[model samples]
Target: MIFESSETSGFPVATPRAVPPSGRRPGWNKVPEVTVYFWTIKILCTTVGDTAADLLKEKAGLGLTGVSVLMSTVLAVVLAAQFRSTQYRAGVYWPTVALVSVVGTLAGDNLIDATGVTVETASSVFVIALAIVFVVWYRRERTLSIHSIDTTSRESFYWLAVLFAFALGTAAGDLVSQRLHLGYWLSAVLFGLAIAAVGLAHFQLDLDAVWSFWTVYILTRPLGASIGDYLSRPSGDGGLELGTVVTSALFLMVIVGLVVYLAATRVDVTDPEHTSRHVA
Candidate 1:
């Protein structure tokens, strides 16, 4: 999601550097209900998502549109299951993210492959749409902090923002690699550096948490996609020859293991009363 100056909305906002509550639950927070483990596994999942989708289309003989529709339907079911849960459940949440990642990547891929829209144009459209969603969300709620995502509306907005981020990331990544001809490894390195810069800005420069989180979140998608492409694509195409099936299987196993661990440890629950402390 795009970041905007809070001053534009005329809302009474707290200082951006405010500390989050001490008693926050282990899970269920609006800030992407996963841990660093969540991020690690999420990147892995995205890699698998990209590779698996390609395999389905190229090897399984399902065309781009067919794979998109199939994965989108699966994603819909998983996302519905996620929304139905009243509290954070790692078992449900991570799989939902993985599925959505695949679906979102496929959506972007379809736009490029089927509709012939330039990645630059697709990136611009998604970025604008995500910005609008964020602006409307902030205007209505008076805050864009994920820590405050307790209500249905906030959660809905959160997931929608995530979906768009994945799509935007796909387009942006493709634009950099294909259109800009940067190559997969170089693009991956660039996005990794960008994420590190955002982290530095967040911790050292005291950037807004919500903005930092979303920015890094978007960067991770391309980073993951690059990694996936580098692993699965042939050497002639500037990638290793590992193949999509192996890459997907390996990443899926890692994601499942991490999600199971999170479920057992309860690492992502958020306490309702403590939500206010994170509003900045």
Candidate 2:
């Protein structure tokens, strides 16, 4: 199997990596290739995550704690299946992401709505937690590039960082929109602009790709959350009033359709033409 590592490639950095001479791993990278489709499906998953949390709480009467428990169980099962797979499988990977998005949303909610922690305080807490995860991950692995996720430990760190990103996004989104009254559409626009600036910096101003990727990843969560709220919330609340169920169903269907296409085409697989390139 091909082992994609950044020991001698991709955005330059000062840290050293431990790529083997062969650069081939006993197992392939368990994560999907980063592509436009990946980002599209990610935003859809986030939107569904935001709306589904509302549905589970209000429609299903699970409350914040109950939905948290239920989704956490589901996330655990899906993540176990993810860890068992040796290669990137859309069937397993995207489902785990979708479940993670939901659980992450609920986690942020429980901290604020249940524990009376202000969104600002909660957001700050998650920021510190995420920073600690990154420090620990990089200290151990000497690399934070997702392209290097060919080992179980690297994959574990990747998912942990992802969960923290989602939670942080939720708290920050609420703090700005719900607590500060920026409104959903405006919040989405602001985040969209921020991501665009990041892209510009990475491409034109010499920003680091690894940092750019992580920054954009975290920003996408709030963008998706804002979009979901704008579509599902009532007109009285300045939303389009589409309702949570409809919003969730629409995004979920789109995500499923895209995943099916991705699985069939394998278009997102990294370099099918040279899957055996040696790591330098």
CA lDDT scores, all candidates in order: 0.75, 0.82
Clashing pairs for predicted structure model 1, backbone only: 25-269, 26-268, 26-269, 27-268, 27-269, 27-270, 28-268, 28-269
Model 2, 1-280: lDDT tens digits are: 2223233332222222345423435337676677778789888988998999999999778778878999999999999999898778898999999999998899899989999999999999899999999999988877776655667787899999999999999998888786668888999999999989987887698677678778888899999999999999999998999999999999999999999999999776655323334233
Q: Candidate 1's residue-wise lDDT over 1-280, tens digit each?
A: 3233222111111223343334433235533343567578778877877888788888867788778888888888988888777677788888878887888798888878888988888899889988998999877655566655656777788788888899898988988887778888998999999988987876688687677778878889999999999998899999998999998988888888877887787655544443433343
Worst 10-residue lDDT window for candidate 1 reads 6-15
TM-score of the candidate numbered 1? 0.86
Colliding pairs, model 2: none
Lowest lDDT sum, 10 consecutive residues, model 2, at 7-16
TM-score for predicted model 2 compared with the true structure = 0.90
**lDDT, candidate 2, residue 65?**
83
